[model samples]
Target chain A: MSEAVLSIRNLTVEIPTRGGILRPVDQINYDINRGEILGIVGESGAGKSMAGNAVIGLLNRPAKITGGEIWLNGTRIDQLEGEDMRRLRGKHIGMVFQDPLTSLNPLLRIGDQLTETMLEHLDISRDKARKRAAAALDEVGIPAAAQRLDSYPHEFSGGMRQRVVIALALCAEPSLIIADEPTTALDVSVQAQIIALLKRLCRDRGTAVMLITHDMGVIAETADRVAVMYAGRLAELGNVRDVVTHPEHPYTDGLMGSTPLASKGLKRLRQISGSMPRLTAMPEGCAFHPRCEFAQDICRAEPRPKLNGGRSACHFPIQQPAEETA
Target chain B: MAMIQVKNLTRIFDVSKPWLNRVIERLPKAMLTAVSDVSFDVEERTVYSLVGESGSGKSTIGKMAVGLLKPTDGSVLINDIDLSRETDGGKLDKARSDIQMIFQDPYASLNPRWRVREIINEPVSARGGNVVGLAEKLLEQVGLSSLDADKFPHEFSGGQRQRICIARALASEPKLIVCDEPTSALDVSVQAQVLNLMSDLQENLGLTYLFISHDLTVVQHISDKIGVLYLGRLVEEATPDELFENPKHPYSQMLLAAAPKMDGFGREIDPPQGEIPDPINPPTGCAFHPRCPIATAKCSAERPEMRVVRGARVACHLAE
Candidate 1:
């Protein structure tokens, strides 16, 4: 088997607030193999993005990684600080953010941006980088890539701009890409194109991807494995088909039920009643107990259960494993 | 009779540069046809959804329907009264009162400084109607506590804010509410809640909805009739079941095929051919012809008018 490109172990991130220390990302564990896409699915404030930000060392002040380790290509990187982390970002870990407009510099030409990233991370001549930049754009399905190289960011449409963003993220040829809601701002057709582009590029390059999104459909289509996060904890983790088809965690189940499927006719969507709990006012045991229908006394009394050689972090999961069922 | 009738609605925006700049650049006056001769009717208490990509004029049509913007040509009639042409002040005012609009962003739509009470009651009080306790009543109706009327908008979550927006839309007791991408900004769970709430409200109050959205699943879930818009033109219209099951228009087919699905595991679809054409200078005949997979000489030389193809109204020459 191919080695894990990125391995996260017992990762925890905390924000120090006047109210209390909010663990936005609780102790979570996962790994992404070469050419695999691991989808982190959750609601807002569920710490999916926080987990990604923690890995890329982009966590803002007041929020810091308090525990655990992040290993990239067999190197322990959790303690890497400032210059070292900055250098590692573009060279090894590429990022695709939700908004293409903000992710790119409005003032620079698309070609120059790509070449600059390539020149910074790679040992290549200016002329070589420029040619490679155009090739990268062409590879991303940009029309007239050579001509578009001179155009400013504002000159391109939203979908084309996103393609440029993907090109920029890939020009350096990082081994792992952290895409946080990459298709959220795009139209459906454009989104499909972008997802396909990302998938094809990553697979061809054998780049591991950590795809963080709230949309299950995107995950279902693009991801190889799935991680369901709730209240800053890994609620469930398994193969995409298994988790999506039979969600063990109630939160995961509720999320699947809530997303209106096109194949399903006009049936009332099964909404998980109540919103996600605030960090300041988190529930006693499981953060999802209040909204979860199967909550018991133990769910409210004890701390949230941990995933100990199990697929889900629940006292009573909705689905048992095949061996357990057998 | 239909509750809302939009007939040959056309809106053009002057997208030309400033006169001096245009002269310097030697550029002609650029006109963007935002909504082009589009027509649809919303029956009383039914949901008619307009689904399209950005720059397809779904929001523009929504704005025109709710009288937020006047059409450059054509008319929008609410309850059989032409909102733009009716000169009778009393009749126009009555017609206007029967119509209200719910915007996409709950955060940006509501005033930041006002209390929920004032925010919800503004519609009634602006016209010198009885505003006392109206906010509280609507709050309860939208599943919020009556006491929340006194609180500020900041205190509530996104879903709650949307519910507040819904409550405000209902303050005037509008018969037709044009909701433009109402649940797009929300998470899926919250979106489901809001959708269910809107459906319940529509059924209970007999409200007619002109729903505009980019999400096909949401539109399919809620709409009685769905219209597929491409480059400011209504390309197809059909019931949700028929549209989803068998879309006639190529654009509609592409949209359905492109939309990500939960059950679509490892499904390989060719990346849709091209981006939505520049709206300012759309293709000569069918604007979608440029990106259409099965485009022919006829598709480019002459536009196709809406004709009933099977059970759906499709505007594609090849659709039989």
Candidate 2:
């Protein structure tokens, strides 16, 4: 792959407690190319969001990125001080969180949110930023952008609020956009429309997207590559087609099998056997060993998973071919 | 005999401006016709699903079926018991006990402050129903542990909370469960667990379900029969296999195609176009005609009554 816009290498996050450091995100490495869409898939508490936060310099307190290097266009961002990271945020990196209503301040009008980013990042006048704001809204397919700019988040519909969030993200023209479960809150019909909009905008603008979600259907249709995380570790990383269609990890395979594809009719959908264990105390060996069908004695002795071998941490990954999988 | 029979059931919410303001503005009362002449019957121990967009009145229909809302006109007969505003105290309580409802938002439906055991036991204690070993039995029934019953709603996952909701619904030992978007708020992995639990419960308890949701793929799996709603009206109703395979109404066809099918391989079929029409002022004739690509001039002026076409009741002039 060409030089990555955002490269995360040997990244790990630890949450300290009375006992000791609880490792939430194990050492994982991945990169988002200039225009590529990298999907991070996992169940809740998979450390996918943690990884995204670590890169964006927005990981909440008590959650520490203990060790790792984040390379943003060859600059070591992890070591950057507070102001440097702050300066780098909107100009280089943009973020769209899952809940649009929460991301945006309730009181501020939509126009203010968009213009604030442009003013801070691009040395442009308010008028110029204001003009850019209307155009940005249009790009995200928000109808009546000019009139809508003055409306607060409450006035806009769920789907429209998301479009406004996207507009704010794109207004700065950041090289990388990390969207965390952006469309999960939206309805299926509106969800399809939003996904289509996000994918198209990213494609045409050649902007790299770090799409983090638990939905495989979204990854299948939008992401260029997929990274499957489990209990704070990368379970599998490969091209979207490879990871989605021919997953090597049992967890990945199980996730795919469980999803009820519209194509599959009448057949009962499969489900992963157990709930994701609590993250407070992860298992010694593979985190997924408790639920894996093919787990052997050897699988339980390790603390974490491997980052290579075409699948992460697995001593014996599922060998099903692409077509045979799911 | 049908376990639940709904005939011309409608709910028109008075969302109009205040009475005095309407007079001053020289405007008529703007009533939102949430459900319009919706008619269907749910068979005993079978899953009948209503699939549509928000504002289409799917939830309103569910509310009416559970006696939570009064129907403006027509009737909802559950086991030959006609439910209406006139149905007084004893009859209403009996009807409610027989038909329990699971809401869309698990967080909202359940009290966060209350323990799971208390939430599930509320109905049991209120009705003075003899449900022995309730908390533990219900937890196990919904694939959760007895320990979870003592914990608050926050402690559980989205899927787990929904399981608790199902457990709560089961506490009454209701004959019919109105599941309104039961799995919509959950993840795919968790959704399977809930759907499976619901199916298993139905089999074990001989429960009839009036399942409501906007998801077609999900509806296909859980529903024995499916009904497509538009602006509170039942556009089409049929068996799951029949509706999915040979949907006659243009709106029905578009809805099926709009849902992202994991296996379809993305063959190009035009999705249902146009926004959902305003419920307060729905279009003349067929409400879905404005959005339906195949709608002719006749569809705009004349409402097509639901008729048996290919063993499915489809309301489309074109289908006729």
Candidate 3:
């Protein structure tokens, strides 16, 4: 995959709950090449965010990566601890959360936040960091970057505030970014603006992005490759266009059909009848077998079946050759 | 005849601080014209949706529709009963029972301390009716078992809670329900399930809905008639088929184009330009003229009123 910038191999995240040891993310594997946008799509509690968090080593308390390795540019990082991981975070990897306000300190000026992150990672003077911070703001399409440096987060609008957050994330010059629902809080019109800004900035800098979201439309618009997760497992993974138009896994297919965009002229949406299984109550064979429309007797008794490639984990995946012509 | 008629409805929020603070800052009294002179009609048994971004006054309009918030100006007539001017208690009570509301966040709307039974039966018991039998029936009608009435809201998922919200709204036997961003907080798959249930309920019970949301795709899927709002104004109103196929207003066109669609995969879309102006000090004429791609001098100089054009109401100086 042309020297993968980020490679996740056999990743698993576990939580020691009162009921039992809960595996939120189970043995997921994927790769993001330089400048590539890999989108992870799933419903709530699908462990899409957990996998991203595992890569950044920011898993919340009571949840830790129990198995597998995270490789960043030929270096193993998941085993690193404390200061090593902290240093690697701002220097090698950056993160953008759903809420901009949470990532940013409301009391400090936007410029201060950007400069602080930059100075921590790079061997640069305060003056140089200040200049670079302004440049970063301008790069993210923020108007009057020089003057805006003095402005606090409250002074800016929601969309502008998110832009500032992105500028802060980019100021460190990290090779990879983990954006978890970066535009979910933004308005639809403003959402388009932020997505375009992110895409352009990442392209020009050749930085890889791991975009975790529940919106398939966002994935279709921005991602190079798409990975579909269901009940803490990878259901399907392929090129964005193929996965979107012709999903290999039935879960992905049901997800696409459930979206309002795909329900045109249809009386009722093609719905996946039940909710995702609780971690403690996961089904015996396939996690999605209970809701699968094409489920057979074998599907309930056997674990996920291997496809010709690692593109799908379904017992009877949607045939590919027929999809190409249709 | 329209089931609910809102005529020149306007709501203004005084967002200024105390009088002393205004005087100290040498600032005039700040007021936000949330919904300004907006007018529309909801036909019985039909879904009328208001689509717009935040601060466009769609939710404020919804609050006014259900009498949760009184308008600073204009009138709301529900089934010929004017909500503002109704002095007769009997008529006002009937109007209140005929209309109900479903909020955006199912988590916050339902009482945490109350069981599902108490939550659903509030409307029925408020009017001195038997809540036990009605609660059981509503729980089943919303696709949950009658036993679920004894459980708490935390026990259910987001989709199930929304179904409970729907059941509570139906308990009053309301003819009109105001749904404010009902499915926006939900995941796409669960959103579909709830939408399907809502559509079914409408068909079976002859319910009229005022659906408000920011997502154009969901609005298009659920709406019979759709209204596009921007900066407290109804910029366009038309049937979903007519509007989505060919939007008349520039703002409407921009909204349709900017909405991320699954069909046009890998195509680079031109993002919508510019931020929405501050409502406290909005642009003089058309609020959207500053960002409109096809703006003329007339658009900046004077506001455009709604005009009938090709079976739709469009508010743009250049709209034909």
What interface RMSD do all candidates show, one decimal each? 1.2, 2.9, 1.0
Q: Candidate 3 — which pairs collide?
A: none
Candidate 1, overall lDDT?
A: 0.91
* lDDT score, candidate 2, position A175: 89
Docking class of 2: acceptable
By summed lDDT, the worst window of 10 consecutive residues in model 2 chain A runs over A260-269
**Which runs in model 2 stand beyond 4 Å of their true positions?**
A105-109, A144-155, A322-326, B17-28, B85-93, B111-118, B145-156, B263-273
**What is the lDDT, from 0 to 100, of the residue B9 in candidate 1?**
93
lDDT of 3 by residue, A58-177 (tens): 899899999999999999999999999999999989888999877889999998999999889999999999999999999998999999999999998889989998898888999999
For candidate 1, what is the DockQ?
0.78
Q: Model 3, range B84-119, lDDT digits (tens) per residue?
A: 788999999989999999989999999999999999
Binned by DockQ into CAPRI classes (incorrect, acceptable, medium, high), candidate 1 is medium
> By DockQ, is 1 or 2 better?
1
On residues A1-326, what C-alpha lDDT tens digit does candidate 1 reach at each position? 23999999999999999888999998999999999999999999999999999999999998999999999999999999989998899999999999999999999998889999988889999999999998999999988999999999999888888889989988898999999999999999999999999999988999999999999999999999999999899999999988888889899888998888832665577888999988888888888899888999999977668887689999989965678568
- Model 1, position A68, has a per-residue lDDT of 97
Angstrom error of the Cα, residue A263, model 3: value is 0.8
Q: In angstroms, how far off is A214's CA in candidate 2?
A: 1.8
In order, what DockQ does each candidate have?
0.78, 0.42, 0.80
